[model samples]
Target chain A: MTTQASSTAIDAEAAGTVPRLSLNRWTFRTTPVQEFLEATTSRGIEAVGLWRQDVEEVGLDALRRRVDDAGLRVSSLCRGGFLTASAEADRAAALDDNRRAIDETAALGAPTLVMVVGGVDRADKDIVGARARVTEAITELAPYAEQRGVSLSLEPMHPMFAADRAVLSTIDQALDIAEASGSSAVGVVVDTYHVWWDPSLERAVQRAAASDRLLAYQVCDWNLPLAAEPLHSRGYMGDGFIDFPAITRMIAATGFTGDIEVEIFNENVWATPAEESARIIAERYQELVLPYA
Target chain B: MTTQASSTAIDAEAAGTVPRLSLNRWTFRTTPVQEFLEATTSRGIEAVGLWRQDVEEVGLDALRRRVDDAGLRVSSLCRGGFLTASAEADRAAALDDNRRAIDETAALGAPTLVMVVGGVDRADKDIVGARARVTEAITELAPYAEQRGVSLSLEPMHPMFAADRAVLSTIDQALDIAEASGSSAVGVVVDTYHVWWDPSLERAVQRAAASDRLLAYQVCDWNLPLAAEPLHSRGYMGDGFIDFPAITRMIAATGFTGDIEVEIFNENVWATPAEESARIIAERYQELVLPYA
Candidate 1:
């Protein structure tokens, strides 16, 4: 793999076309890693956000080589959080796992590790305590991630997912935890699907940018009649209720010149051919997101 | 119905027990209004928050007489704000409907009119604009409500409902709108199921109380594996992940000795006999919430 810091530049063929748009691998959920990379590159897409499973499936080194060969940069790792487990042993195991994720992110040359911090344990009812544990875990992991030259990107998932996916449900809350970590390695992800409904979003985004904690931005739409599988409810830009222009303007205003990852998790989206999905994502990015960005 | 203002004291039998337990009519969703009122009173419930449909179905005067006969005080009215319509005529209609609701609340002797402010219109994608519209509508309605001695209680819904139900999805946003209204008639409702995931809830509650905007308190559990129909996903107090004691403690700390309305919208709870549902609610309130309050 080319040993350069993650680049936001598009490949020669894709140069000058939505350069900051990265096709998140989960958008092609069922595609093989190599094929997804090929499809993304063939569609003039120059970067991607990979999941741990995708790296593990083809072996990390091989995946990294394939990504490099395709002239694509890794935007950010899919996840490395789940640190809200209550048991000490479980919490410790989670931290060890996160450290491993940090190494993988570094090895891939990704600058940030997207973290979907854990929610309340099924057996536990203390969400406040669970959230405190998440803050504590991030504080402990921040230094280790910093030592590896990686940033821990805290993702504030939608409130619907607060019970099982992530306790950090707003950008402000993520910023609070990130600030408390007292390490530059700690930052926040502003994913439109999770935060588009926030009334305080403008202020939160400004605060995140002011503190230099706005590390990555993800785009997707918040569709209605929520999908049967809530986790997979995201839709392509402009296909749902999100006003990408308004939110994108806020991100652009922050001077955030980074990859804007398009991460859709809908089952219908997964059923599309990877090339078709990539093509549509690029076109939608041009019409809906790029103007504001 | 009892002619005096909404009372927090439970009926004689329930007074020494859970004195502030108010049975929200939606907990008996499918039950007839008269029967629901009788079931609530027989369970020693002294107060109730009602849905407009419940009053209209039986005729407002008829329902009022039924509530008075049952020795129940009307705690609050279920709704009165869908003011996010983009069209002038639609918005005007919404305000007119809200005025009617306020009059009904006054006639029923309820002190508060719960407002579920409308979300973005299905045909539109301007959530920011929609939210602004909500603020404006409430500002216009607050004075009308104040003159009638009714407080317009803004119920900030869960973000999942931000698309089809309410655009105001956080207590702080509701407070901002309420405070801006510059009317004592403007206030907020703290529903545990909606605000439980908010990391800033403790501070929000404190602020709401300090400003005397804490008009009502609603309780219901946020159950996992969300129901098939999300609108009907609420469970009884002890049946889900919410920490009632902690949240209740915050309200108590504010000296909010107001009615604690148990408002569950679950299909399963509705399937249970009305009496049985009321019994379980009273039992759970005592076991999980009363101790803290």
Candidate 2:
């Protein structure tokens, strides 16, 4: 329940070993699971956020072994819970998929599973209805996630993604659903790229922290004049206009000492050699994000 | 304070003559003011949202006379405020320009002057500071706008444009500033292109309308997978996935009987001849927007 104003001193670099950056698999999503794992470890990163795609390819158990052997903690699982389907069969299927994601998160020893609750139903303009469905879906999954020791970290994507990706576009909105669920298993992801434009973000962070619902924190720059494939246009830390120090300061004020994942989706960054991408992430994370964290 | 639930019926065809559309000057930004004026009136459109560039070229008096001669109403002025500047001189300069804009809006018989309250200062990531400056700048200009009988319509642009355009990114946030100014002259522009993704839009529209602060409503679909120059990527209705009928229904619930401006910034739409663009806009307006409003 920490709502401390952002600290102005004790820079992460000077403090040392405290505020380590986590790498999400999506950053080097183009690379093989094994190669990516090795690259992250070689850089001495402490934790990673795993997308289901990589785990599926390598098989969950084998992937789990790889993460454990590399001494990397899973900050959160990539995603689960796209509960906005129109069909009876499809809606039921989302629950099953989320159940699997929770099991995998628990299996990987990850405390949280990031949930980018899906977009509205086809031709469905009822975002309210779609959002209601998300709440209902999470309600259904909350118990299962709790049973599996996995928290559903609802990730509010940028509003630009509201149409095609996630209808949840603000931390406070995600927190609203989290609160209504009445379960500790439900939480919110305070991703900088997704929420930097939020005017009430500082207060939202305080609210999340007070409720102890701040689950995972992700970082990346918002590419100015947003890129075409918005899912892929996220810039490395210092490359865009986001005020990392300020945003990270908000998260830090929440007393959230969890992994700050460098979850970028830029095409150009991903197109580069995986190793190079890892290096850039480390540099930016230190220069722009770490000091503030 | 009409807090009635959104109207579920009275489709535009049945309601008729009410909720007339306003053609924004930027839709045909390349065309001469005279040509643009003729194209709009030819379609029997009753109102327009004039851009400053076009109005400047035609000279304020000539454009005002032309609008008057055609019996077309000026829905609102294109823009006035850009107060985000690090230097006091630059900011003072913006205030000077906005005063002139307020005078022009008065001369043109427009009730409101849209203010894209500036973005972050140079190399400054402090969006919070920039947003504060907008409130201050608006407070400074609020009296001038009121004296001229023109409301300062603070437009909350889409978050994508937050870096380089309006720091205000939500209807409620805009209304907060409008309310804080404590003046009838301070109102908000409910531009769908900028605010369609807002989860709080429906409620904010009602709140603004209740406060009698909703001075304008601009319509344009968000180009899915936002375009490069977000400033110009706005799509004609139906070109993107915005649920206009639903959004307009929300606005209508607020009892906002005003011009719905078709303010597309799409390069493709602009590339079309001004007359054809008007034709397309009218078609989309009738089918997508008018039904609900």
Q: What is the interface RMSD of each candidate, in Å?
A: 1.0, 1.6
RMSD of each: 5.1, 4.1
Q: Best by lDDT, which number? A: 1
Model 2 residue runs over 4 Å out of place are A1-19, B1-19
**What proportion of the true contacts does each candidate reproduce?**
0.79, 0.66
Put down candidate 1 lDDT per residue, B1-293, tens digits, no spaces. Answer: 12321233234334544577899988887998878888887877788888899877888898888889888888999989889999999988998999999999998999999999988886778898898999899999998998999899999999999988899999999999998898988999999989999988999999999999999999999987888778778999878888887898899899898889999998888889998988999888876777677
TM-score of chain B of 2: 0.92
Tens-place lDDT per residue, model 2, A38-146, is 8887775778889898778889989999989888888888889788877789999989998998998899899999898988665666678889889988988899998
Give stretches of model 1 more than 4 Å off.
Answer: A1-16, B1-17
Best candidate per DockQ, number? Answer: 1
